[model samples]
Target: MEISTRRLKLLAILGYFLTGITGGVIIYGSEKMIVATKTPILIFMVWSGLVLVIVSLIGIYGVIKINFGYTVLSSFALVVVSITLINHLMYAIIKDRSEVESDRKVLKLWNRHMLMGRAMHKIQDRLDCCGIYGFQDYILNDKQVPVSCVSEELVSYIYKQLGCKEASLREYLFSRNFIIFSEFTSLLLNMITAVAGFKLCSRIDRGI
Candidate 1:
């Protein structure tokens, strides 16, 4: 395809602008949400989103080239952030439900994971897992569950109930969490990639 030099510059500039804007919005929203909510999860989102926004900004100047390094880090960032987000997001939205049957079903496995994880922890307070930096010593059962080692039995039951035909307990626990988040994160990922692809396509459209 024949290309024009000026259009290529425009495409690159547009990529820089769009990513920068998205990153900015996420960063600002995260900061606001952090202050507004005392909940552990919201605090976690602020922290995660802060990091993600930073990475996204890296794309602004040089996402296309190998030297950018943004592409390398983004994959790891998205996967980790997505899992944490899904579990907590689900918990937050489900809080109002009166343990109703449909609602309970949606929540049961996730709740069990947290409960059994807490029981396994069996500690007062030290490290906050997946929430925020530094451990807050106050325990809230009505407070959030502490980070802990989950029991094997709890893992197995969750796996079986979730329709696992194969019975590897390890597969159920760690992998299941990934499976739960993979779908939601894919949506976010598509949004990101779509924006990126658009920037690239725009170059072609303009004869860049």
Candidate 2:
């Protein structure tokens, strides 16, 4: 069975488009879970996703134009993104998970961003939690426990027992691990498609 140059190009373009779409959806879905949790490592996931999408678009354009230069650029970008993503995943996997759940770290992160504060408020409200550690940790400027800390239900229940630190930590670790796996798989596929496309373009240019 023989494949034509045009068919190869089309397949390559499809690969890039599908990979890009998949990545966008994955990031969007994970954003809600990670939104409340602020950390330096999370920023790379956002930036790398954007870069992958851009490079995927470039790859599609290159396939359409039959331009090897564009294909090479896309391939190079994919390699860089793949390496960075792998490293990020390694760090996430190898790092001390307990340290990431520190009360002080969570509190500092909550204070760093107003958006994070809003996110945490929403999370706490939904989870019926008080603060990072407990109600005592919520004291600020003589302010009482936030409304979220109190259970809305009149029935007896332990609302204050659920702390944001543990909830956030669970969500963060789950989301991070999932993102790492997804991106790593997509990166490998995208790199293969990119390299194949580049070579096909070269062969076509040389009239092989």
Candidate 3:
């Protein structure tokens, strides 16, 4: 019985450590886009990571104290985390699927929406990319290529030849894959933590 308790405690601690790492991964994946895009999904991703870390901390504390109430709370928190992660995962998949189709739409709306234009400029500047497909996108659209497309040196060779479309898409795909990986990892850990938590709660209740 003592051995079982020790094992359960160890499992909970390990889960907590992994969960913290998973949360950090998710946060790191989305942090940059949060300010640039101001998208709700990115904000939610950040919040989800924070919540997971907090819940894992609570779970670790519960396991250490052998407190049934805290253990139960942690189990419930896992359910919430699972739901959020599922939602986040689905959104990411959908966005990934539609990304190619959305390129033209983005280009069309580039000059129309002030917010989108600023966001595109920011992305171009940060990625050292030009218009959607290339600088020719501006030419084709009869629009002037912004200064963001070029380096400070203003040399022709230094000008960004890559398009913001490809650059941003590549970045988004990488972030999406990273977040998906973290979410799956977190969900798996959540299950382990939930099972271990419940069993520990039961053992504590039985005074074992």
Candidate 4:
């Protein structure tokens, strides 16, 4: 809603501190693993992620002292985190589907709809509304169901979360706002976190 400058600064500081701690842990763990395992790719990753984390940390200071600077930076940081979070969520959905049924309990009634087509068909019979597969994509009088349970959920989640109030997944995907800022904030935060962490970890690439 409406947050004052002071509130924003406080939020920024908390966000920065947590991000920094996590990034620090990642860097430390990676360093030790890199040294012990001698994995080239992993080593490089440590440095790259470290850099992003540090930049994010600096964004915190900028936000607190430099006025709206941190807000701008924090938006970017949010983007970064959003991207990674979306990626992970996708991965989870895929993983869940591959190993077991995609109908996780957490997904609620949606779970029953995915695994058992018959059950979904029955649900359609009960409700005047169209058949719900994941959240949207209702089976109409004439429509073919697509495969990929994980993809179904992913699209559905995005569509419902960012979609028009009444629009289905089909319509939500086409929303201009979703396309533009779908994951913008997350990408920014990811970059910020990485940059700040790298800056903080001086001994990373240079071997200090």
Best by lDDT: 3
Using all chains and alpha carbons, the TM-scores for the candidates as numbered come to 0.36, 0.78, 0.81, 0.37
How big is the positional error of residue 159 in model 4, measured in Å on the Cα after superposition? 60
Over the stretch 5-58, how does candidate 3's per-residue lDDT look in tens digits?
889879877887788778887777689765434355667878988888888888
Candidate 1 lDDT by residue in tens digits, 1-208: 7435455445544544544454455446545433322234435544655654564555433435533245434434544555665666576545522223323332343355355644313221211121121122213334453333222343543111221111122222332243234335533653554344344545445545
Local error of candidate 1 at 193, Å?
2.1
Model 1: which ten-residue window has the lowest total lDDT? 124-133
Off by over 4 Å in 3: 1-3, 35-40, 87-91, 94-96, 100-105, 112-119, 139-144, 152-156
Q: Give the TM-score of candidate 4.
A: 0.37
lDDT of 4 by residue, 104-201 (tens): 21233345555654444322222212334333453443335423222224343422222112122233222212222323443454555444433333
Better of 2 and 3 by lDDT: 3
Tell me the number of clashing residue pairs for each predicted model: 2, 0, 0, 34
Q: Compare candidates 2 and 3 on TM-score and give the better one.
A: 3
**Candidate lDDT (C-alpha), each:** 0.40, 0.69, 0.74, 0.43
Worst 10 residues of 4 by lDDT: 97-106
lDDT by residue (tens digit), candidate 2, 1-208: 7677777887788888877886686566556555555555555666666777888899898878877788888877777777777777778777846445546556664565234344356767644566776666657534456667777777686457677777666766676666767777777777777666766777767976
